[model samples]
Target: MSEIPPFEIIRASRRSISIQISKTYGLVVRAPFSVPEDIIHAFVDRKSDWIMKHLARHTEQRERKNNTLYYLGHIYPFEYNLLQKETVTHSGGMFTFSGKVKDSGMEQAALTRWYRKQAQIYLSERVYHFSWKHELKHRKIRITSAVTRWGSCNGHNDLNFPWRLLMAPKEIIDYVVVHELSHTVHKNHSKYFWNLVESIIPDWKAHRRYLKEEGWRYALPKF
Candidate 1:
């Protein structure tokens, strides 16, 4: 708390200066247009303890996120290896990437390709299992890289799901499958949709809440 950490300043038409912490950007200072540079520096110095506390928190979260990978709703330690032969492998309670990727772009592309293939194989089987159990019919199963959507059923009856769903637990995945499959029967999220979803997954709301709260953690790492 003795010295202020590095931060970027953005002066705007405002009355006060505020500090914001980011894992990627470190710290940011938003100040009023009339606030002098020295005044902003003094204010940041005065709040050094608080700023340092948040920075420490961000650091811990960043490290934890970097070290862990979510698969089938479980957190597994992850590693990258440039000298190994296999592209990727899940063994000994770890998910390791052994691709000879030279950069992060190549690394991301390789990992995402693996994630998409896993999604296609796993989700297709689950969708079919549920559809067959309930006597539902679907045209096709598509694994997508959708950011904002988890699963959707269109007029063509093709069930679309994001590869990210593979990061959630199996029950949660099943809930999404039932939810979208129900959409095949009920186009809108009306009373009938909820009723049907409840009929299939009695705790569908809990799973949905889990996704709304923690689903953001399920994504490619930023290193």
Candidate 2:
């Protein structure tokens, strides 16, 4: 029989077996404490193909993220200078930084700070431009660190957008801005809500498709 791939097994007070794979943790299996070791082994065997596929994906994603950084629909070469300094700079298609970035954690934190600042400036401007053009009255705008959503509109009329949106093209950014602003008028995604979005940006569907297919690649690394 083929050897089962090495994985960490955590027996916890849980109801079922679960598996996870990531760049940091290669493969992990969580099972009920009462499950037999043989059963756990069998489960892993059954999931080996899935585990291998995800492991390969994680590996490729890590390599790509490490190699490049995306900003404003442009791919920039990320450069780090060991010399201590205060901020990151972008010029000539490169993001250069000279700071106390001794590790990947520090680098990711500094990059996130820079991206958030840019998002605050750029996204706020787009939101205002669209709101004024469409007569949408939103209470406030906030930049968020949300991973799953590009933007959201709460009951208070406040709009929140993920800082990672700065990495997408301006059209995609406008689509998200218009989407949330439309929420100020229509709380749900009824036909009217979609119609409102289309009125503002007729090509919103194309932007949505691009974001759906490619946006995840531009998410800030989790270090």
Specify the highest-lDDT model's number.
1
Q: lDDT tens digits, residues 1-223, model 2?
A: 4344688998899999999885577888899989998999888888877676667667757786655788988777877778767567888879877776457777777888999999999988998898888899998889989989999999999999988889888888889999999999999999999999999899988988998767767776544
Residue 167's lDDT within candidate 2 is 89
Query: What lDDT tens digits, residue by residue, belong to model 1 across residues 142-216?
Result: 989899989999999999999889988999999999999999899999998899989889999899999886777
Candidate 1 segments whose C-alpha is farther than 4 A from its true place: 1-11, 15-21, 24-61, 84-86
* TM-score per candidate: 0.77, 0.74
lDDT of 1 at 35: 83
Clashes of each: 0, 0
